[model samples]
Target: MSGHRKNSSDIHTPDLTSYPPSPSPSSYSSNSSSSKSSSSRNRVKGAARSVAGVFVSCFTPPEEDAHHNSSSAYGGSDAFTSSSDISGASDSTEGRRRGTARGIYATRNDSTHMKEPGSTIFTLAEIQTATKNFSPAFKVGQGGFGTVYKGQLQDGTLVAVKRAKKSMYDKNLGREFLSEVQALSKVEHLNLVKCYGYLQQGDERIIVVEYVANGTLREHLDCFNGNVLSLASRLDIAIDVAHAITYLHTYTDHPIIHRDIKSSNILLTEKLRAKVADFGFARLAADVESGQTHVSTQVKGTAGYLDPEYLKTYQLTEKSDVYSFGILLVELVTGRRPVESKRELDERVTARWAMKKFRDGQAITVLDPKLQESDANGPVLENILELALLCVNGSRKNRPTMRRCVEVLWNIRKEYKDLLA
Candidate 1:
């Protein structure tokens, strides 16, 4: 075990001496007495063997056991169930014990079970039927990774199915798909999207998630006609997004950095409540015990929203997400895309332009004209713009933590409410 080092304290050596003694031979010479004693001895041996079998099973790796049982747990479909499918089907006492044993082993190994431990495993054919064989009419959205289709399960449950692009079935994209499944399945929060389950068959990979009625925050901003998302709604959205990021950074079992935090990745419910979607580029923070401030890895994120420090050094910290959120805040206030080609060079980058306006005491220039025309809540909007500037600062050290960002937005929101009240 070159790579395997065990903690001595955690290794438990079973006490074999505690086992019951074998049944002794009967002294009586009667044939009937001898037969009964022999039967009783056989029962004792069988019981002992059962116990030994369970103990040996416990020593087997959880992932291996999960793989072995996957076919049985889910209907044996090669394209449908891999080790990733951990079903919620009812089981007997011994089956439960085996599952619990695997869970314990997984915890000891510093790995987590797939997201949604007992999520339903749908067959590829089932998913196809749900989406009308991937019809164009069912298409809801498309991204760099794949196309998302809206579909209804047989039970009338609405779901958004994300299908991986054929070209994206390569090794790198496959890893990303599994990573997203692992992250979304494990975490549950009001502002985070819920992953119902996933489908993986050969080159076809699909994720089934709860469908948010209002589509994406990007869609809202892009299609803003007039008087669509009110200033109050925008503030609420920023707060919602901030709270979600805070949860990922501090409240989870481990810090999760949503490397992609842009308007397109933030979805809205019917009430316009923001839910953070897309964990394809997310990464867990460095182990706390390791005393590492950040996890160094390859740079991967959208252009304008990416943190400059991360782009230069390839070292990712929670501040990277803070920087992106700052850009999103600007998007909420100004209704501008992160990167715009039609504008002049200095103003082409929304974050850079907003920061310049704030520095020049002309923050009003970056405010969406519609917001300015309203002639109310102007001061609150300016305060938010200032906060966004602090978030997108060139130095990561200057950016506030997500918790702090949430606090500032809440305070501004309260002030605006009081004015209206």
Candidate 2:
């Protein structure tokens, strides 16, 4: 845990001014992955240090940094980035190629190619045929929810099939299926994983979605995809995620707090554009316009990313996701996770340590070593960590809404790009 592991980035200690809270960044699972290995876990939030030499910031919490300075959650999921994992199918070559620079799936003007919001009920036989009786080779990702496979529909449409475990379904009958269906079927954006359909027969429950070809942001962080993300790519990804979350919180008919927003849940394209996926932990947020401050509910989300206020109050709000986003921002810049249990005590909580570095005029020390230091990246990094602290403020009321995140990131990107130019 000391020496540079496969996932550990080299760092240069340099002083930076003070700040509050934390954030991290991507590299995809539609937005999270299931890489359970210790090394992979550590690499999940590696960095946004260098985008072909572009620059950024990483933070220290104002108050909470003193409370939980160690990581309680170490990894997001447990698995590898198989060419065949998560959701999606194989059929059209146009769909399978993640390398296309075309930008949108089927293009923004062509809505005809998109799947409908409703589920296209599939028979178990079709599912069996598509996945070759659920062959092990067809498997892509597996987690608490179940297994994800690559499959092809009869008409040649490709999809990623997420089949729930029998034991889990037998106990609840609907949690995963109902949750995914409720969340995925309600919205459609270029940045969100598209749900093709689902099936709930007997002990079998499956949710089929459009396959994202590249990998999860976590996998990219670990360079599991055989390439490292440039700092510019990371910025674009942050923007993509910001847009997706903004849509979920504001644009959709019903507001959704992703509840789980980490490197693992972020999926990427060959172009490396990000798409937010895995709605098993997604929840509808309380309507703030109606005078509701928060949604009173059970606490459910990835450990390290959970909002401290939500943990104390059991009142969920969109700010909860913002807190997690702040953690991810910290991860992106510092090349670390919110929790790193295997590391030395003080180094265990990535955000707190990075934030403290930022506070003590050592922000440069916390950046992902994969990136080279430069004046161009300095201010960008500072503002990024600054925004992260604002988002991860210990008080939910102090956190900016997703829309605000978009605005701030937009400014950061513009500034970074300008500096680079």
Candidate 3:
């Protein structure tokens, strides 16, 4: 919208990895089993190639794929079921089944898109050895789901492995995991986190993610005592995040509502760029007419940013994500936690307090105290404050879509460029 040339090195560029195109309603409802299976297989292969290529291109001295011919990965057991749910049938019996299913001609619908023979099954011990027996030093963070650790593979690839509690890996959880994979495989955006793969071994479950070094936006905003971001940088981050959400809600065929949108879930890269993470609470907006489409589930999401309409009706829509994104914009603008407020007389949430000040033309009072001494009056800051106000409007329908938000921010960025030049 600004007519400015975009950076070739920008993370959002297309050459990085092609995102799977979202499946249409017709594709989703395809009646032909063979056609659907073929489509699914094509999607899976495309995703795998893209991910593999990304790692190869970025990390120097690329390594070959671990040879699958050797049974060494699973301790010489040709048909060992690493999943705890599967029983230990003798290798003689299981090996025959695997061999019969080996040839591409004999393929049928399998739970994992990959043919049985080509599947690389890593033993629990292999992971344990790779992770140094899950030592405390490797621990990254703990959340309601589980603990994540930074692991370096024998091949020297860095990965973030999440170990989930047994209950969280139940059958229902697996379905959700598949859905999450479907959602992420088709989405490649700078502001969205990248998921590598998932593994299930007996009772243990692991989610391997691309390791991002900068940590979460919450940590950067609230925890980092010194080195606060310049006003321009903060606005840039807000705009980037908004653009990502815009892509999710508007670009996808079935609009995705990021049910949980909070600073803690927004991870930062080494460059201090933001990427939305944690899709456990995300859901697709159900079609209005198809009663079967939008199944209602327990209301899930972070509290401070949850949508009131969704909370009231148990029905979520894209607007719900817009509402949450608005709250995030407010957080970026004020450097205040969603709920934090020090106002003595009126201990209202920062969103309300900031909006009040914004309307009164005294929004400067709500600026992060640390920014007071700096050049906070610049056009970038003014545009950011205005965007924050638009995001937090009382009515959800009044909020701008992510595309509109991106355009507005792009304009502001152009203004900033002109001012500087």
| RMSD (Å) of each candidate, 1 decimal | 19.7, 16.8, 18.6
lDDT of 1 at 210: 75
lDDT rank, highest first? 2, 1, 3
The C-alpha TM-scores of every prediction are: 0.71, 0.74, 0.67
Model 3 scores worst on lDDT over the 10 consecutive residues at 82-91
Clash totals for all models, in order? Answer: 1, 57, 2
Candidate 3, residue 15: CA error in Å?
38
Q: For model 3, what is the error of residue 52's alpha carbon versus the real structure, in angstroms, after optimal superposition?
A: 21
Worst 10 residues of 1 by lDDT: 65-74
238-312, model 3: which lDDT tens digit per residue? 776876776566544345667777888888887778778776556666553343323354456665676655554
Off by over 4 Å in 3: 1-126, 168-179, 223-225, 288-296, 341-347, 373-379
Identify the runs in model 1 with alpha carbons over 4 angstroms from their true place: 1-118, 224-227, 373-376
lDDT score, candidate 2: 0.64
| Lowest lDDT 10-residue stretch of candidate 2 | 1-10
RMSD in Å for model 1: 19.7
